[model samples]
Target: MLRAIVKQGLRASSRLAVNRNPDTSSYVQQLEAEWETAKPFSELPGPTRWQIFRGFQKGGQYHQLGMDEVMRLYRKQFGDICLIPGLFGMPSTIFTFNEATFQRIYRTEGQWPVREGAEPVLHYRKNRKDEFFKDCVGLFSNGPQWGKLRSAVNPVLMQHRNVAIYLKPMQRVNRQFINRIRELRDKDSAEVPADFLSTVNHLTFESVATVALDEELGLLREVNQPPGARKLFKNIEVFMDSFFILGMKPSIYKYFPTPTYKRFSQASDEIFDTCSMYVNKAIERIERKTAQGSTKDEKSVLEQLLQIDRKFAIVLAMDMLMGGVDTTSTAIVGLLLSLAKNPEKQQILRKEILGKLPSTDRDFSLEDMKSLPYLRAFIKESMRVYPVIIGNVRSAGTDVVLYGYRVPKGTHLLMVNSFLLKDEHLFPRAEEFLPERWLRQKDGNEDSANVLINNSLNPFVYLPFGFGPRMCVGKRIVDLELELTVANLVRNFHIEYDYPTETTFKTTFLYKPNFPLKFKFTDVKY
Candidate 1:
């Protein structure tokens, strides 16, 4: 219904007063205007105001007035890294958009608190907030609680170890991807769809499901988009929009989260519902153990989650749906497009792969991946060029100084990674995707080829997985999934961009290919 309204430009009165202010971008205008005469948020009884704000929260918009607004606000307010002596009573200081700042903000959490990230997150959590905040869920909680949960689960996800466990599933998904593309392209290998975004989504859907839920979608085998997968992608978009509006115009939609609000509210429920289904499946498996009085050793991550708390399981699952799905898919789309635009480099990398072990018949092991330095370099370059998450903001846990500005506590800090990736000073010929730049030369010779994100470079500058103790916990899972899937795809077939344009940028919120990409595969022969 809301989609119909949006498509048709249908009209209706806002259920709650929209913000009427002018300075707030149109995104926040309605809420800003609404705040003009609305009751002070603190004065609202119970959770009415909190609910309204949650219904319409839009944090991304606040970040995306471009970095200029973020910079100006940090400078104008308490200068940088200052206290949030406001009504919310939370400790926060906005940091300058730099690398050192990221290190200070994230590393200093022990002295301060990771709970600074919790309020907005917890407040927005609808059904599973309690469980998400409980003692054992590592990703969503803080302090001793986060420590315990992380300790239990971090082993499975500890950088390299987790990659070994799920390598086969990723390889399988990629082969499935190759098969699906062949089907989609009739006799003419040229018949492949111009856009690979949907294809990557289908691939990531299957990949993450295998690792996270021990389920498979075979979305590629179906040779059509998955219905829920399709909706799940859109739900992510809609929810981001809902959150952006809330940040832009907190007052406007706070009281009247209508129409758009309701659609997302429904989507939010659906997200939780989807998560619950997975959680329940894990729970049932755990319950079988409980029924027979078996020990926790007969458990997977999902089973362990069931033992700790189901609500947290549901939230983690939802986070995967929201976080895991789009990022991996969008990344691969950007990656293929990058190679398509740079055909010479693409061929070189393809030759490099074919020259190596050149077999996926056995389980594609991490060591196999380790052999493909160029493949690793190409993936790193793609991540640098088209990072799915440009940067996520951090509210300082306490007052800190950054870039000559006093960032007061509670001030919202926007970490601009897009700024760093594109900065010519840090990366000479920055726009050009040169994997060789990542390689370090020993003496004057092209000696040891290495792939590291330039250690001499500032830490806060580039954050694809985000920065701080509160950084993305599943970073390894995402890296492994992308590496295995993309390597397999490239190893099996050469990709050409059906369409290429430098100006193409799909969405403002997250980095995506500007348009649909079609690919032609030059079937590799060993």
Candidate 2:
């Protein structure tokens, strides 16, 4: 049925193309002809609304395979593009794996791109009695509202110089994390427990808090942690879990407060209150410093953001804490696993680190980070192989053509490019862990010859951090965090995973490892 529909569309397009007029410019006429012949949105191929509803029901294909696998199955059946009829009050979505379509959609996304996924959070913020979010709906918001928040925070978070200020503080947090790992590992086996991901979460929270709140939460400490830190951590966890259900899956969270929605709301409230308290403390501290006439050259991310607007600072801090912790921790775990499974690649990365630092005690400077190409390449490769999110989503900001179909404005577009990361045609030997593939020949390194030289590689196919104006604001910070953590770990430990099977990941709110993280960390002797 899908093949027949596609053929009919192609035939129609061909017939329309032959009717071009000679009076108008060829370019204008061609575009008009293409637009007129494009397939109707209804004729785009995928399972029907009833089929989607039944498929998600008990013991159905969607239920058995899960959304990630179901997407792959659809790709196989319907080719590169499929229109998913929304179920249970959700908007209809178009899923495309075509690189050209991805590029076209992103390039045309106007001044303010609309990323439509966090409906539950938006609904919660809008309906709050206090109207705390009336002025700013935060990073999850759309159009001019989101644009305002993003514009205010971009200079503070996106600049390299601004982000570099957090390196020393985050390094302190990484040291504690390394120490905590040593304490948690078994004496005989040298392996951390199956629940080591929790520890990683703590490490990430501590690191983010250093930048977001300008205070050491000491979450990785064995003895004393700051008050409300652990609660904030737990709440963020619940928020992530519930966000997947209420925001991603079908639910009537807006009309009626379901059990999942209630839990999500509660978690969100705690997260806001705790972050607000810390932000207030930060504000008082800043005021006190100012009163005393203190001139500190290096200010925290929060301090810089607070200079703009107090409320914006608080909202941005909360969003960073909620978004940064789980996502970064998950990415860190994935990178560590990649290093563990491929010992040679780990050693190569370690050699690069040691060549620059010479000793484990040496502190990471911004200069040191700039010189380490292999370290950066390793990170890029890891993300390519194990992307945290399945792909990016953007609501069509304007009428656009996608794979010969006219997508109307406000239609949800799911760009499923994760599969493209592993396509052999795009990246030669896509299964192997080769960091050298990311190294450019312009760097004039010995590994330049080994760099996978594919001229046809589309940049749009490999967007781990997304694209356009809505690209991740914390990208600079997250990059530094991953670099610091991995550098410290590799400098001190010979990481290994002794388990027979490989670590696998599942897609929830993000792509997280589904298996136990029982990694063995042996000390590296100089």
For all predicted structures, in order, the TM-scores are 0.73, 0.92
Per-candidate clashes, comma-separated: 39, 0
- How do the residues 179-258 of candidate 2 rate in per-residue lDDT, one tens digit apiece? 99999999999999999998999988988899888888878988877669888888988998998887666677777889
Clashes of 1: 39
| Shift in Å, residue 151, candidate 2 | 1.3
- What lDDT does each candidate get? 0.58, 0.82
What's the distance in Å from true for residue 317, model 1?
Answer: 1.1
Query: Could you tell me the TM-score of candidate 1?
Result: 0.73
After aligning candidate 1 to the native by TM-score, how far in Å is the CA of 36 from where it should be?
Answer: 36
Q: How many Å off is the CA of 231 in candidate 1? A: 5.6
Q: Which stretches of candidate 1 lie above 4 Å from their native place?
A: 1-95, 111-121, 124-152, 189-191, 223-237, 244-251, 285-299, 442-455
Q: Per-residue lDDT for 454-513 in model 1, tens only?
A: 436775665677644445667887877777666666677777765447555544446556
Instruction: Give the worst 10-residue stretch by lDDT in candidate 1.
Output: 8-17
The residue-level lDDT of candidate 1 at 83 comes to 27
